[model samples]
Target: MPGYLLVFFCGVLFAAGLGLSGMTLPQKVIGFLDFAGEWDPSLALVMVGSAGVYFVFYRRIIRRAHPLFDVSFHVPTRTDIDQRLIVGAALFGIGWGLVGFCPGPALTALVSGYDKALIFFVAMVTGMYAYRTVDAIAGLRTDEGTAVDG
Candidate 1:
């Protein structure tokens, strides 16, 4: 299969999984986060299932010489916690908690015809472009360090 075709299939499968698991619903995510309210543990189970699947297959897939669609696996090698990671994580958590919509699920939720999904996605992309522009103007190599290249 062609690489783009494989990607399209994978996305469709992912969206289907999200739909089947109720992850595309913001209420489901909000329910999970509502510790003080009628707490829903179903999302936790879904997360666990997804994580377990990744745990089982991650090593197996990484052991391959190369993926069928990609020339090289672009795995991150950085392990140490840094300011960027910390800030990024905090922002992600804040966004998720405030809006109850994660990026992947948000994209899937777009088909639901909710205006908030579109708004959130637009803001997310705007933030990304804004960050890149700021980073470029700061003379910093993306994800590298504070020093400017001579």
Candidate 2:
């Protein structure tokens, strides 16, 4: 399908951008986090550049009738910050600070046969599955038996 192909191509492009930006390297990310030590501000440029581009395009895309691939814009309706969000964000930050490998960079680095990347990827996947299992078991429903967002 064209949508699937577009998604694949976009993923490749994203991976390529991460590689070219030196984001696939744990050392680069760690260096950026090392404020009291040898800090690398170069990654900030990459972040800012990405945010700027997304800011421009996100506005333009939302204004359109619909996306090229989807019938509707899949936007989050939830606005209130809750315990689940805080805990998840804290965990993500801690993992990123420790391994210096978020999902995207880790996946991109996996192709280069990086052992750490592989390890992180496995752990990340396990964590995701664990969360899903727990969430499924502990899922909350309303009086009408409709699933509610946490």
Candidate 3:
């Protein structure tokens, strides 16, 4: 109801911001990534602006007892960096550098009927499914080993 509507509105706002900031353009993202070559500093400014806004509001928002739509704020508990996190981050960076389309902007570009964006989205979905499948298999193996040990 209200929560869902708020979520929808927020999503639309985020998409509009991405579009207006030229984040939906692959060339812009690629240019930003190309530091050794013709580097674009606009995306850096966008990131700084976004970080500033978050810094200004995140503390105040988290101090609230509950979110506007939820019982409590959902926050990450893990603070330690591990090998898996490092590997995942490296993969994400490589993918973004190579394709010039992260998930959010890629999704936004899909509305424009861009074939590359569609391909990227499909590949992203496939990667997600693949990760889930591997994780499930690993979980099953761990469960079986624990049961045998017990």
Candidate 4:
């Protein structure tokens, strides 16, 4: 229950930060992406500020015995880039460029009852489900092939 409360509080804080930073507006994000035209550097500034904060605290947090809530920190182990990673990154970039709303801001904007945010969220969820379905099917096929060989 405490863990859930902490997570909820963090989520609220994140949403508030996004709203305060003008990140909930698709137009702002689109403006930032428009380098040839009226390019906005505010988002870049926000990114830099966030990175600075993380840089200041990330090492200290990691050096601790464990997180306050979790038993261990689940950091990513993989450092190698692959074709799948490249393709996924490209798709993510294209989606962000087209809609001007990534998952975080899109979810945050949904509270304002924006139709575009709702549509984007639905499409994003559908894409996630589609990926899971395809991955599961591929895994089953691989398992069946291994069983047949053994």
CA lDDT, every model vs. true structure: 0.81, 0.82, 0.81, 0.80
lDDT tens per residue, model 1, 1-150 = 699998999888888888898888888899999899899888888889988998999899999999888888767666666565566678789989998898889887777788888999899888877876765665543465443211
Candidate 4 — which residues are off by over 4 angstroms? 133-150
- Misplaced by over 4 Å in model 1 are 133-142, 145-150
Question: What would you estimate as the lDDT of candidate 4?
Answer: 0.80
The TM-scores of all predictions, comma-separated, are 0.84, 0.86, 0.87, 0.85
Per-residue alpha-carbon lDDT of candidate 2 for residues 62-110, written as tens digits (9 for 90 to 100)? 9999999899877766666666566667888999999799888877777
lDDT winner: 2
Candidate 3 lDDT tens digits, 35-141: 99898888988798888998999899999999988898767655555554566678889999998998899888889898888999999989877865765654522
For candidate 4, write residues 20-126 as lDDT tens digits. 88788899999999999798989998788878998999899999988898998766555555554566678889999998998899778778897878888999999
Clash numbers, per candidate: 0, 0, 0, 0
Ranking by TM-score: 3, 2, 4, 1
Model 4: which ten-residue window has the lowest total lDDT? 141-150
Best by TM-score: 3
Please report how far candidate 4 places residue 100 from its true position, in Å: 0.2
Model 3: how large is the Cα RMSD against the reference? 5.9
Q: Residue 60 error for model 3, in Å?
A: 0.5
Alpha-carbon RMSD of each model: 4.5, 3.6, 5.9, 6.2
